[model samples]
Target: MLALPTLSSNGITLKPLTLSNATDLAEACQDGELWKINETSVPEPDKVMDYINTAASMPDRQAFVVIDDLTGKAIGSTSFHDILPFVKRLEIGYTWYAKSYWRTHVNTTCKLMLLTYIFETLEYQTVGWRTNIGNHRSQQAIERLGAKKDGVIRGNRVCRNGVISDTVMYSLIKSEWLPVKLELTKKLNDAH
Candidate 1:
C-alpha cells in the first residue's frame, strides 16, 4: 500500500480523513450543487459520515481531509486511489471541495502538495486522473496541472447518481513531473 503522508504547503494541509471531520465536511456538501459532478456524492448531510467511512474502508484508498490552514477547518477531501503497485501507477482523485473554496488557490496548492509527494517522495512513474466525460470542470483542472489527456473510456464508470458515464482519463508521467511541478509552484506563488 502507498503510504499517505500528511502534507502542508501554501496555506493548505492534508491529513488523514476521519469521522471527526464529518461535521465540517457535511457543511461543505450542503450546496448539493457539487453533487452532480462528484464521483461519489453523499445524497444527504447524514450520509457524509457513511461516505467517509466507506472511503476509509477501501484498502486501495488513502483518503484525506483538505484543511484550510488559516481556519484549521476541513474544507474538502481528496485521495490516492486506484493504485497499481506492480505497474507503479496511482491516481489523485476521489476529490471534492466545498462550494466556497472553488476557483481559489486551495485546489492549486493542494495539488502541488499531493503531486510533490506522489512524484517526488514516492517517486511514482505516473499519477492519473479520471473524470466523468461531462465533467469539464474537472478535466480542465487536471489539464491546468499539466496532466495530458489519455482519451476517454466509454461508459466505464457509474456515478453516485446511478448514471453510467464515460471516464475521461489524464496523467502526468515521470518525465513531465519536474517541469509541471515547477510550473505549478510558480503559479501558486504568483497567487499571493
Candidate 2:
C-alpha cells in the first residue's frame, strides 16, 4: 500500500492510526461486547496500543483513526486492508466504534468519507468488505451502503473466539459506487 493520507468530509476525519490514539481507543473499547463479532479485541490499554502498532505495520493495510468532528476526539477506528493497487482493489475491514457511537451517524459518515476517497481520489475499482458470518449488525450496515453480498468463505482464522469462522464477503465495484455514494451522502444529511 502507498502512504496513507488523512481524509475528512461529512463532519468526520480519518487520520493515520497512531500510538497516541491508544488511550482514547482503549477507553472507547470499554464494552467487551464490541468484540463479540470482531476478529480481535483490546481488553486493556496496552493491548490497544499494540493493536495500533500492529495495524500500522501491515504492509498492505492503512488504518485510520475515526475522529468525531464535533468533539475532535478519537471515537473509533477503520481501515483499508488487503490493498492490491496492481489490481485496483481493497478491502474495508477492521472497523469498530465506541458503543455510544453505534447506530449514530459516525460510521455512515466515516464510510462515506472513506469510500469517496477510495473510488474518486484513489481510483480503486473495487472496495470489498468482510465480517463474521454471524455478525448481523456489520453485514446489515455494509449492505446498507449498497455493497453486494459476494459469497461466504470459511477459515477466516482471526475470529474473536479463537475459532476459524466463516466470513461473509461483500463488494462495491466502481459501477455501483455512484449510487451508493449518493445514498450515503443523503443519509449523512438526513442524520443531521
Candidate 3:
C-alpha cells in the first residue's frame, strides 16, 4: 500500500481521509445535499462513516478530504484510485466539493497539487480520470485540467440510483504535464 501524504497550497489542504473526518464530511455534503446527485459518490450524512471505511479499505485507493485551510473545515473529497504501480499510473476520481466552492480556484489548486505530487514527486507516468457520462460539469472540469478524453465505456457501472451509466475516460501522460502544470499555475495566479 502506498502511503498518502498531506498536501497543502494556496489556502487549501488535502489530508488523508479517516473515520474521524466523518462529521466534517457529513456537514460538507449537507452544503448542497450532494448525496442526492446520483452520478456522484457523495454519501448521505448517515452514511459518511461507511463511505470513509470503504475508501480506507480499498487497497488501491488513497482518499483525501479537501479542506479549506482558512476555516479548517472539510469541504469535499477526492481520491487517487485504480492504482497501477507496475505501470506507474492512477486515476483521480470520487471527487466532489461543496456547491459554494464550485467555479472557484479550489479544484484547480487541488489538481495542481495532486499532479505535481504524482508526476514530479512520485515519478508517475500517467494520470487518468473517470466520470459518469451524465456528469457534464465534471467532464468539463476534467477537460479544463488538460486531460484528453480517451473514450467512453458503455454500461460501465451502476450508479447510486440503480441506473447503469456510461463512464467517460480521460488521461494525461507525463509528456503533457509541463504545459498542463503551467496552465494550472496561471489559472491559480489569475484567480487571486
In lDDT terms, which candidate is top?
A: 3
Model 3 alpha-carbon drift over 4 Å, by segment? none
C-alpha root-mean-square deviation, each candidate: 1.6, 1.7, 0.6
TM-score of 2: 0.92
Candidate 3, residue 90: lDDT: 96
| TM-score computed on alpha carbons, candidate 3 | 0.98
Better candidate by TM-score, 2 or 3: 3
TM-scores, one per candidate? 0.94, 0.92, 0.98
Q: After superposition, how far is residue 125 of candidate 1 from its true place, in Å?
A: 0.4
User: What is the clash count for each candidate, in the order shown?
Assistant: 0, 0, 0
Could you tell me which residue pairs clash in candidate 1? none
Write model 2 residue lDDT over 121-172, tens digit each, in one string.
Answer: 8899999999887779888989988999999998755665677788899999
List the global CA lDDT of all models: 0.85, 0.83, 0.94
Question: Distance (Å) between predicted and true CA of 92, model 3?
Answer: 0.7
Deviation from native of the Cα of residue 31 in model 1, angstroms: 4.2
lDDT, model 3:
0.94
Candidate 3 per-residue C-alpha lDDT over 1-192 given as tens digits, one digit per residue, 9 for 90 to 100: 668899999999998998888898999999989999999999999999999999989889989999999999999999999999999999999999988899999999999999999999999999999999999999999999999999999997899989898999999999999999999999999889
Superposed by TM-score, candidate 2 places the C-alpha of residue 142 at a distance from the truth, in angstroms, of 0.4
